[model samples]
Target: MIVLDYPYVSKFLVESVRDLGLPVLDTPQVRELAGGVPLDYIDEIEFSARLALGGKVYTNSENGLEHVLRCRCNEDLARQVDICKDKALFRETVANLHPDYRFLRVSHAGLSGLDLSDFPVPFVIKPARGFFSLGVHVVNDLADWPATLEAIETERAALNAEYPEAVVSGAEFILEQVIDGEEYAIDVYYDAEGNPVITNILHHHFLSAADVSDRLYYTSARIIETWLLPFTEYVRDVGRECGFNNFVTHIEVRVTPEGDILPIEANPLRFAGWCVADITNLAWDFNPYECYFKELRPDWDAILEANKGQAVVMVIGDLPPGTDRESIGSIDYQGFQSMFSNTLELRKIDYKAYPVFAFAFARMDEPELARLKLALAEDFCRFVKMK
Candidate 1:
């Protein structure tokens, strides 16, 4: 039996598990299916009890529910997850592992009364535990500090207003040195024996001159062809240092022009947001959810050998400032696809607030594909208008 919980109990994931002919229960539906379950609200204690009923539990979401199971099943993994969620802990843990492991100097700050006089120029300000790039800003210099705080505060306020239950009240913000390099996300899952398996490596394309808002990401079979050896070793080292095993890890890394790789952060148990891991099925003919639950260790050498010459890209539909879901009508899919001849999938996201996100998958080669990604990010608004 497999128990699914909130944020992870998506139709895509549930159906995928059912396809395996396994008995899966979504936490929320437990009472509906079993009338006497006595689960009034779905929470860590309730979900933890369900997990004790005998089979494996799985969740892609980082919410407390996942951590509850981890705490019960694997204390070390739970620690790793907690550390990853807190950026400061993650930085300190990794940096203490090796002398070469470098992280930018970071200090906690509040929305009001933040001082930047002694801080380095061009630093980054973000919540210690942040998601979807909310409350993230680049402080160019002392002059940009005020605007940066205002932007973060405004975004945080709007988010809290819309989702009061998920408020970030009294959340600690961290200011850190910004790395200069191209960003990339490496998705991997480690087996029970702690061996790392690389699922897919995505090149994160962001708006130039702006440090936030990843506009698009491109993943290709060639990623394994190019960085399989070194990247895997790097991840394995990080995993060992972080003391994580039998877990899903999404590592955000920065690659410099001189070929140095520095980790930005590690997100556990969840691949890219919004079921983006499903894109791997189109790119590699494998299901990530199945791989994790079934403890399948991929034969990367063989998988890469077979799936050469394949590529997939995901474009994010970021809502412009001052725009909400009600204001934006719909995406011009026809016009959008016309720009990329190899478009595989395109869809507009229905979001409640600003910074709305959607994804477009495509098959194309790099260098050329890089240009198309930029064009899509720049011209995304052209395809969306007021309702």
Candidate 2:
């Protein structure tokens, strides 16, 4: 029997597992007494590194036995990719790999004397590796490049003085033409056998314009069949060539006006936060953890089967100016529910507050979702309390 520290496991994940009658071991005391779960002692980053190295682990915690499932093949692949604070490399990599794909070419602030108004509106500007929206600016003209570049430089200087380690000295900022399209995430999951199966596709909406972080919705199987499969194949080939197999990859993409799908960037990690949970509830009728356990699969066919013609609504805050989480009080969940009971699946009661919160998610009825979506938009109007 394996024992593990409970603290290392996610509470929501553990609870879901516990609800089932599966055999397991957990709790820090028991783990401490029994020797400890196989990998609980390692820090998260270290754990991720070790797992990437083809490590196989078995341990139990406050929840039960959790198999640190990973592909045994590509353990040392992490060492191959050069990690640096260079944004030029990012642009170069994309251009080199997919020359035909529409992309924004970026030049350094000092190097390029391009006009913003001369180009086009809604182009993106940021330091190769920028934080927040500090060094990021969006302008619609080539004429505005001078001012925007100035803004970028000022922010860059401030960041260098304040958080030197976060920015590489003499870092070059790049301005790229932003693509027009809906944003989505492709969640890559490797099965126990080492095959990369796209678990879910999600639509991402942002918490705020400044941050540019997004809320997500599970992609219907139909959407995947129509749009995602080809892209999936493309990435699969690329990832395999890059020696990335048996791990999760979050690829951000946009669908263009020409109906072309273009990948913006890819994260070599799982989508952090409740996003995994959100995708789980709407598409699978169970969240990611439950899918991990393969339990309570209410609609196994529907879950795995794509394009069952369903949709999920993600609610996010467009908070009024000067208001924050502490300022609001006595929020009414019931009142909110009365507005959109039909499609409501999960509500994001509070997501870190401030500029990016007050959101709800509704699972629109599959093959029958339109009416519910309308109901939600009409019925839901209660202000979420800040405090």
Candidate 3:
């Protein structure tokens, strides 16, 4: 049975697995574990207090299931921050863990010694333990620190009152050094036993010109070369060191200003998004969602070699309310089906759903590939219009 986390992530997984004709266990598997089944039965578990009782729990190495649950990493890269009651430890650990990483600590009061007047802004600030971009602010001028800190403090106080348990152990704000470089997301898979295999490299594009943005604007496979393979290998090594395997990891990274790839964050047991399988299926001839459930691996070399010119474009836009299928024209079930017979692979297209959108997996034969990619993306987005 396929188990999932919360409903948002679970719905997509359940639907995709069902589409592949598989039975799914919809209940939160954590409940089952609490009820007395062994820990290994749980495929993935997020961090929580009950499981960490007295700081030890049983884990099965054979299936690499233990890594699926949140552990030390949740506290921060240094294993110092506790998801519950350890904010001060978190700030201290994060700073100590990777002093080289771009880090900035924000607070109700400005962080001492980080003057913004200096050129080449080096850091950013936010609530120490904020979510969904709350209280996240960037400071370039030392002059702006006080104002920014005051606003964050106000927000932090409100959040603490509402979610005392969620508050960080320390009252200090989040300070992060900006990692300057291009951003790329690596889709990685670990064997049931927890060894990683690089699947694909997808470039994420942001609609906003600003440097700090959370929501993903668009994604496509732009380039993959032999040099990047080593980068993927390094990520695997890091994952192994962390004691996690048998899951999908969305590792965000930056091509450092010095031409080195440095990891921004590693999500141990989560897919980048529900759309990953769709991107791989459309751009390449393989399906990751299928791979996960069926325990199969696609020949990456062959797929890359065969579909060298193909790319997948994710439409970045919002769907208004009351939108319906008629806006996009009749679902050309037959015409749409015809692409698979050709070289094109259309990933998941939900015409009947809100925020109506479709992705075109197109192949081009010339150096004019860039132009063709845009044309195809436009057609795909237009064809699935939102009212």
Candidate 4:
């Protein structure tokens, strides 16, 4: 029996699991159309108790849900997840394994008394336990430190106001030396036997040279053709060093101009956020959800053969501050369609605040991609309003 939880069990995942001839016990919030044993009447504790009796429990839920699962179900899984969520802990773990890895931890009280003179310029600052890029800031020099702190303070206030229980609330922050280069994220699952299998690698495109906001991500067959071997080997080494086994992780890394790779962080018990991993279906004709539960490795040779040179970019729409879902009157679908003729999917997220999420996918070249990205941003501003 397979146990699934809230915010993680999607229709696609449920249907895919059923297609594999497996039985599932899903949380109440999941749509009934997915055809699972519904457990909506019971609370998370009861749900967890029921899940513990099952053979394999599957969840993509982060933060609170994850903590509950760790406490009620699996201790090892919890430890691994905790290690990943705490940037300082993650850095220590990696540094212990690899001498070159390093990061600094700052307490909440220390933020006011931080001495920036000793540290190098151009460092990255983020909450020790954070999500959705909340409280993330880049400090280019001592002069920028104050602004960065102010931004973080504002972000923390907004986040705490909106999500009082978020991990970012009242959490210490960590600072790491910024590694300049291209960034990439790879999703992996280590099976029951502790063998790691990589499912997908996405190339992250930022909004600008100075801005670190992830505006777009593209997956292509070229990742496998170029970086599969070395990247996978590196992940395996990290896993071995960290004693991670029977886990699912999303790992981010920076690749220097000379081709040196440095890990940013590891997020455990999930592939990517907001169903981004589903892009594999279009790129590889494979279902990662099924692969994880069934412990199956993708047919890389066939997938690579069929998708050579083909790419799918997922353009994320993060609107500027003060923009809310109600602010947007309606999406001009026709105008949007005309702007990006190659668009495969487009939808605006129903959310409360700034960084309102929307996304579109397309297969196009560099110039077209840039144009489509700009057009999407503009269309969002044009169609949405301050209500």
Best by lDDT: 4
Q: Write the per-residue lDDT of candidate 2 for residues 1-387, one digit (tens) a residue.
A: 122332233334444444643233333454343343232233434554555565433232212212232322333433212111234444455564556543344555453555443444566766665432335566665667577667666655555542243333336556566777777776654444445556566766443333353433445666665655666675665465445544444566787777766666554434323334445555556555444334122344545565366666555433443455466664565665454445454343342332444455656545544444354333222555545
Off by over 4 Å in 3: 1-15, 19-99, 102-120, 126-136, 150-173, 207-209, 214-222, 226-228, 274-277, 318-387
Candidate 2 segments whose C-alpha is farther than 4 A from its true place: 1-11, 14-53, 56-91, 100-122, 130-136, 144-172, 190-195, 205-218, 257-259, 286-307, 318-339, 343-354, 366-387
Ranking by TM-score: 4, 1, 2, 3
Could you say which candidate leads in TM-score? 4
Model 4: per-residue lDDT, tens digit, 310-333?
A: 778877666655565565556554
Q: Which ranges of candidate 4 are over 4 A from the true structure?
A: 1-10, 20-28, 31-56, 67-70, 161-167, 324-326, 337-339, 365-380
Winner of 3 and 4 under TM-score: 4
All candidates' TM-scores?
0.83, 0.61, 0.57, 0.86
Q: How many residue pairs clash in each candidate?
A: 1, 23, 16, 0
Q: Output the TM-score of candidate 4.
A: 0.86
Q: List the residue pairs that clash in candidate 4.
A: none
Candidate 1, residue 320: CA error in Å?
1.6
Cα lDDT, all candidates: 0.65, 0.47, 0.46, 0.69
- What RMSD does each model have against the real structure? 4.6, 8.0, 9.1, 3.4
Predicted structure 2: lDDT: 0.47
